[model samples]
Target chain A: MKNRIITISREFGSGGRTIGKKVAEKLGILCYDSELIEKVASESGFNANYIKDAGEYAPGGFLSSAFSHRSSGPNNADYLWTIQYKIITELAEKGPCVIVGRCADYILREKADCLRVFIHADLSFRAERIVKEYGEREESPEQRLKDKDKRRAAYHRFYTNMKWGHAQNYDVTLNSGTLGIDKCVDIIKELY
Target chain B: MKNRIITISREFGSGGRTIGKKVAEKLGILCYDSELIEKVASESGFNANYIKDAGEYAPGGFLSSAFSHRSSGPNNADYLWTIQYKIITELAEKGPCVIVGRCADYILREKADCLRVFIHADLSFRAERIVKEYGEREESPEQRLKDKDKRRAAYHRFYTNMKWGHAQNYDVTLNSGTLGIDKCVDIIKELY
Candidate 1:
């Protein structure tokens, strides 16, 4: 585990970020989740909040993707992705760590000895967790879950040209709903 | 682990079958891979070879799927699926076991407490293993791998209305290429 990096891609409200943090803590390595947005924001001169949202979640859907290649260089999301990609690689080069989301799995696909993971759970499980973690919102937890997952998937496909959360792309895919959060962390550590 | 079944879905030549066997051995449970085809053949009166090939892998590609809605009674593949589904359910009811391929995971998704696992590997890793296991074929190992995986995916979609090997469909997915066969077996057993 000296130089092995673990990149965690997750469904919304699946507790994947929490599991990544716990695993990194157990392994005594840095866990890059929100820290990545700070790096991107500082380097690209974008607002931290904007980078947090736009860095991982695409602004639009299929229509935007079709028009994304109009030779206008890179759009905002695309530009953010380029900066995040650089920052993510630099962090991985600095040391082993657990990177949560921001397409870190795809970014470090070839450069490092990386253990790519995808964590997901049942919709009901995620819905409950989102309400607990984010507090009640005007939109139902399920609706919010769907929107976040959709936008994140679009952002991933737009940048990586790979389907997000596909099992073939990752070394391990864990269902936190069935296995629970602690078990997921232990399993990831075991694999790492 | 009482009354808990484990279903394994895998890419061809990924050592999933081997892992399933070893896990069942360690857990002292029955592992049904070819045993399933024999049971289907005995009950369905179809040739064992035919059931072996057509039970998990469909006969044709997208064209056949498009035309499968004909007024005629269920086709042979569809009929076999019905029988396999029944037998798989019956087996799960009898006792906990490891069921491989044949979309047993989907069949038991709701009826049983299933630890659904998908196993896959890098193409080069699987290709080398297939040659060692099955002997060299007239066609390259890569060609055989692609053809088998495509048919399996089509069969899964046509029968289950679910994408085959999707991360959302399973509790755990193991990369035998990176984790190795023994580690994959250990991980599945740990989750169980």
Candidate 2:
């Protein structure tokens, strides 16, 4: 096969990151998840923490309209997206890899032979996984899951002008809750 | 753990039936697909071929409206659904099983511990598979695949009052085009 890039967009608590890592391990390729933040931060001269905080979140309506007047200048979200887009395209150009979130699918859509995937799970299943993995110290796991999915969907829509998790936008979609992380990884590896 | 039922709703040429069979074989449980038509026919006293022809297809508008006045006398689609609903419920009540298509997920929603899965693939992939499996004697394979998917979607929507192949309606969704049929079977078996 030629250079094939796999981009994963997933709901929070869907085990997408784990699946991506396992796929990369199996395929002997690189996987980018939170590590993407570090790369973008280093390249854009932004703090990693700031990039993490702004990751996969669209600016609010007021801020977006406020930035509209200075479209040439670009807002914080736009700047972050620009830097991330450049990084994603560059990474795809380098070789075969698995990329998680960060709108990498949309950014590298036309640039690479990409198989875009979306991973999701039922709400209760995701809530249970979230509570188990992250604990319940912050917000209710269910609420947090919903909030994160919403934010990711908003960010994806804003950037790509398309629905975040729609099947039409993806080459494939899987439910990590139904198929365990290992099985999900196996499926992805087979595809790769 | 307990007696669990798996319902697979699939797009045409997505290898859903094959996956269901493999999962059932691995789990040592019964799998229902076209065999459902036989059961429904035997139970309802309808001819098997007639039932198969009417299977999963909603009645035309004229017949539906004609049956509307005498709601007690269901149309061919409604009668088939009624018998299949009873058969599905009875099968679930009996033991663990894998049921493919026929809105099994919706029918057994309240009666059993069901894992609802939707299997799909890209159009070109499905078209290729259809050609390889059923040969190119039919209309164009791509057109056949699209027409079959549209019919299945319509049937599911009519019966379940939900979008067929929608991620929201399923516990998990898999792309057999990307993952391959055997891997899909393995994933479902692992879930089982």
Candidate 3:
């Protein structure tokens, strides 16, 4: 597993971060989840909060159209994406690692040894998990799950021009809701 | 969990049957795999061998076109499908059960409590498992795996009008190759 890089794209409340962490721990490698925001912030000299917020919401149509006009210079979203892409590739070049979310799968699609995984769960399952893990939040767990998934999908599609959760885009897909984080970790370890 | 049905669609040599069996055993319920063939054969008056062989291959274009001409009587594949559908629905009606393959997912799509799981693995992983489990065979394990998946996909597409292994079509997708059979069994047991 020389150039092995595992990129995980997941639905909100799917326990993707935990699964990635467990897999990385099992493999004795580092896992990048929220830590990716810090890395991008440090490397690009952008505020961590800005990077985090930008990463959350997809760019609007106006922003996309504006960015499309000037392909030479990157816009806010494009600049962030480019920085993240550089970090992801650099991380892959370094060694085997597990990456959670941030469209790492699409970023490393051309990498020979990259294993792209998509994790999702049924809506009800995800809702229950969200409720259990986060307790009562401002919005309903179901609404939050849907809204987050929509944003993630939009962000992924805007950047990658691919369907977010389609199995064809991934090497393997896991249902963390059904398998649980530990089992998902076990499976990803063997896969990578 | 009333009227719970687990439909497992899997890649060749992915240990789907074993997972289904373990899940059924843990649930203190019955699993339908090869047993489905026997029941279909007995009920439809079709020879078990014919049913098995027909299930393995996709119907030809000519047969499909012929069936399109006269929609009154069921064709060979249609008749088999109808019988299997009846058996599956009847089984679901009886109680909780785990069904392996035969497009059970699409069959019970309208059921409120149905869980459709798709199991797959990397080609190398599957090949290794087949070699270990089945020993040497006429066809190469890699080729056999591909052929089987193709047949399964075609069969599923022809009947269900949907892509066979797409994650969107399933409630959850498991990579049994990475997780191994036992862990996969545990996951399904918990899920059900």
Candidate 4:
């Protein structure tokens, strides 16, 4: 699994994006994330506005959007998922890539080199992330972690038909709070 | 807080005993584990041997040696729990204890100075423990670990009237597999 396709499912503001970027930089490989979304839009020639609105942060969330588009008649889902599947498979077949999110691992499940990881931290760490990102914390740290976890769990289950944060579901589940993201990345690298 | 009571619930053969012992020694406190069982036996006068066998192990598990007195006909259940409760409270009131396995924390709910803890590990680790302890490596390790966890969960729930290993049930739920028991003990020590 050295030439690994790492899909990091993380809580919002958990520095997952930053970690993915670092991992990609260190490995000297392209990190497929929002870029995949961009390619998806261009390949489909769907209105950029539509893709931006549909593909960006979902106030309605993934499953709702997936379901809403599900009944949008033919070629809608096939087009969207096909674009995603194409980008992911292409990247994986290219040797190894660090994918940030967007059901990439689920799409590339057939690939033997895939390693799925869930990075988590204590409520305090997650809340601190949210606070740093927004500069104004609307929810208390405890409530924020719980709510985010619940939403992620529901979202993943809805989209992938799999349980979230379960030990069996992930090759490794880590508490980044214990030693920050750097140590976590090092551990993952060593494991690889 | 230095002398706060910490309840340690464990999966059987998860090295919980060794971990608790190390924790108690590190904290320079007597871990009231099997020692507490002895006190319960003497206090309840249900016969030291019978109560020892009965205390936290499966209630109806011992079909071999029935109680000599068998105090019953009325309030049988209450009589049984009363002795267990008595030992739990006495130990908490005396001072801090790394009370292991038994529901000492639940019994001392009125005490504000109690921190409940549950320790767990993945199947492989626990299975290895079973093999080491029982010398039954020939049997399926998977089935052994499953049976041990199931029995332990059933026993704990039956006695404590609470779901064992559920994070909400405890102040801290430590994964002993990731963090060895010693580190977990230190973390709990700091928390207290």
Candidate 5:
């Protein structure tokens, strides 16, 4: 495990963040999720909420991508991507760590030895988890799941020019609904 | 381990067949690759060679699928798919085994507890292995690789209505080029 970087890209409410944290704890490494957003916010002088939103979700969004092409020159998403990329790389360089989301997999792909993992689950499973995790909202869990996943995917595609969850791009892709969060962590740990 | 079924879908020249055999050997279970093809051919009353081609490759090919829908009645591929579906289902019912290719993953999607695995490698890695495995051919290895992968994908898509090699469809997707064949085997074995 010389290149001890693990980048976890996960679907919303798939328990990917939990799995990442558990694996990092087992490996005695830092798991960067919200910590990453804070870092980017600090580095880019943007509000933490703004960085969290724009960093992962696309501006025009997955459904409204019909109007994404209108902007030009270092847009907010692009700027946040640049800053996040630098911070992710620096974090990888700093030491062995687990990075969840923000395309750390793509950012550190060539720069570091990374065990890039994509975590996903069935829509029903995700929808249930989101309700329990985020609490009930006006929007149904399924609809919220769809919107968030689409935006994240759009962001990944827009920034990296790669299909967000395409198996080919990652070293391993795990179905958390089938495999379960604990098993997913165990698998990542086994590979780690 | 109650499911006792492992379905392996792979890109050409990824050593997926070899990996499946090794895993089966280690698990003391049957690895169905050529044996499955033979069974399909026997049951369908088609030549083994024809079954090998049509069972895994789409008619009109992947690159040239503009004319794929001209036929109305059950065509050769559809017929082969039916036989394959039957044989694969029966194999799973028999016991735990590693079933390779022919859309076994999709066929047994709900019928059995299958550890569906997709194996893929970089184009360059596959190109190098094809020459070693299949021997030199008039067509370049890369071209052959492209043609084969496309047809396999087309066939899987046509029959299953699922995207070939999509991560969402599998429990685990491994990159043989990065993880190496041995590591891939060990990971699958660990999960099993």
Candidate 6:
């Protein structure tokens, strides 16, 4: 009913980005997915590749090139977080927009107006999505799912210093793979 | 009020266990926390020590000492899940209770009477709790908090295939450290 901010976290193939785009369009609002990345890169003056790299490093991810080797030290965390916080806070202050990932829900935890949604699908459905999206890739469905989730988990963990998918962490956890994307959006629209 | 179940996810050292115990005592129901390990130990035939070790694997934790790892295959996830699922279902079927930690909220998501709550305090408050709990052997609150949470995240992820601590996963997220335990419980009780 009011101008609102909604943050979404979804599995790679769950159509979270697609659904977020649709919801923003339906509501006649701007949606931030890749755009948020660009803003994050521009605000931090970091290479888009680095922002993209750090974006993949969610809370659970440990940069093997850094943390594993014990070679990274403070600079890595500090450098990446600068952009992470800057982009997320700016977007929050900017206006209502749909964020696909980057733990936007956790990023805006203190904001009273934000509604956080966790969108997920069954393994089979998500696997099918990966298969369709990357038909050229030789990797199996299971391997693709694993890689995407691992990166997602790692990125979330490194940033927030919290676990990635505990249900207690989210506002609404749904099995979108089974419910279908539109039905999921309908339910979320009702929730908002 | 009708009988119901409350799922709690808390920051380490925030006295979530104390808060959960008190709430369960008030509601006249069982509180499942560490008890989950024992049940998993029994049902899965894995020793409690091994289950604890399996949990400690911490993300890539499995790659570290997985030889003794207690739940290797996807079917098993991790050792703690068997216990978590068993306890959650048993309690839900038995009637309402307060289930704490171990991703009880996610496991019991199917139940109609479930109320998921995340109780978190500021770092200083959690640090104080850990300091009090460990006494002379106590480590700095931040380190203790990180280790404890990593273990928790690993256990939940290995078992449920879900990330931990993201806000989108829970129904209501509250600042327990700021609100204090009594107020936290009271607010949850009112919501329930």
Question: After superposing candidate 3, which stretches have Cα over 4 Å from the reference?
Answer: A1-7, A12-35, A46-82, A89-99, A105-117, A121-192, B56-73, B131-139
Per-residue lDDT of candidate 2, residues A76-132 (tens digit)? 878898888988888898899999999888888778888787888888988998888
Candidate 4 colliding pairs: none
- In order, the Cα lDDT scores of the candidates are 0.89, 0.80, 0.81, 0.65, 0.87, 0.68
> TM-scores, in order shown?
0.95, 0.78, 0.68, 0.57, 0.94, 0.51
Candidate 4: CAPRI quality band:
incorrect
Clashes of 6: 28
Encode model 6's per-residue lDDT on A26-77: one tens digit a residue. 7777788888778778877887787777677632245453255444455654
Q: Mind giving the per-residue lDDT tens digits that candidate 2 earns over B1-192?
A: 346999998888889998999899999999998888898988899999988767746665422432445545677778788888899988898899999988899998888888888888888988888888888864898888777777777777677788876666776677788667887787677666
Off by over 4 Å in 6: A1-3, A45-50, A58-78, B1-192
- Please give the RMSD of candidate 5 to the true structure: 2.1
Is 1 or 2 the stronger prediction by lDDT? 1
- TM-score winner: 1
The per-prediction CA RMSD against the true structure, in angstroms, equals 1.9, 4.4, 5.8, 7.7, 2.1, 9.8
Q: In model 5, where do residues sit more than 4 Å from their true spots?
A: A1-3, A59-72, B1-3, B60-71
* TM-score, structure 5 vs. true: 0.94
Model 5 chain B: ten consecutive residues of lowest lDDT:
B59-68
Give one digit per residue, the lDDT tens place, for model 4 in A1-192.
435678777666667767777777777777877777787778888865676444332324544554555444434544565576777787788777788866676777777466666666667777888777767766676686676666666656655777665444454455566546876576455444
* Candidate 1 chain A minimal-lDDT segment of 10 residues: A59-68
DockQ ranking, high to low: 1, 5, 2, 3, 6, 4
Listed for every candidate in order, the interface RMSD values in angstroms are 0.6, 3.1, 4.2, 6.6, 0.8, 7.4
lDDT of 1 by residue, A107-179 (tens): 8987789999999998999999999999999999999999888888888887788998889999999999999
- Give the per-residue lDDT of model 5 (tens digit) for B1-192: 445799999999998999999999999999999998988887878899977877666656554544656566676776777778888898889899999887888888888988989999999999999999889999999999998898888888877789988899998999999889999999899888
> What is the alpha-carbon lDDT of model 3 when measured against the actual structure?
0.81
Q: DockQ winner among the candidates?
A: 1
